[model samples]
Target: MRGTHPSRRLGAGLLTAGLISLGLLPVPAQAAADTNLALGRAATAGGANGGYPASNVTDGSQQSYWEGPLGSFPQWVQVDLGTQVDL
Candidate 1:
């Protein structure tokens, strides 16, 4: 049987270290966890006088967004994640 070249072994080691440092290696417990809690969730704004509904925020489209009425002070938009999050 042939042994792996010294340069090849060093390259493989470096690649493994890089992946571990970047968190690409999966953890056993977290591999199956849901990381994003706000995907496709409902969103609502205080007002949509210009036809920009609050749901636009979660439609996964860059062209659309929730726009508050012009000249309105203290505008606000809210999203419901369906569960409490740490942030």
Candidate 2:
């Protein structure tokens, strides 16, 4: 039977030690719950094509999108989260 290489044995030992240390480490407490606070919320855009409205930005549908007019400079979109959130 062939013996395992010294480097391979050392690598495997380090990997095992790392995994065991990670398991013994204390885990952080869960932060605030995760939720999409932007769903169905109010949204406004600087400008849009005739048919496309600013509300489409938060309609939760990729098929629909707000179309800004051509040659419009400094266009932007904004969403209201209804409440201030801490970053």
Q: Please identify model 2 stretches exceeding 4 Å from their true place.
A: 1-34
Worst-scoring 10-residue span by lDDT in model 1:
29-38
Task: Report the C-alpha lDDT of model 2 over 19-66, residue by residue, as the tens digit.
Answer: 767775443333333555667999888888888888888787879988
Model 1 error, position 75 (Å): 0.5
lDDT tens digits, residue span 51-85, model 1: 68888877867798788888897889888988677
Q: Please, what is the TM-score per model? A: 0.52, 0.54
Error at 27, model 2, angstroms: 22
Give me the displacement of residue 83 in model 2, in angstroms.
0.8
Error of 1 at 32 (Å): 19
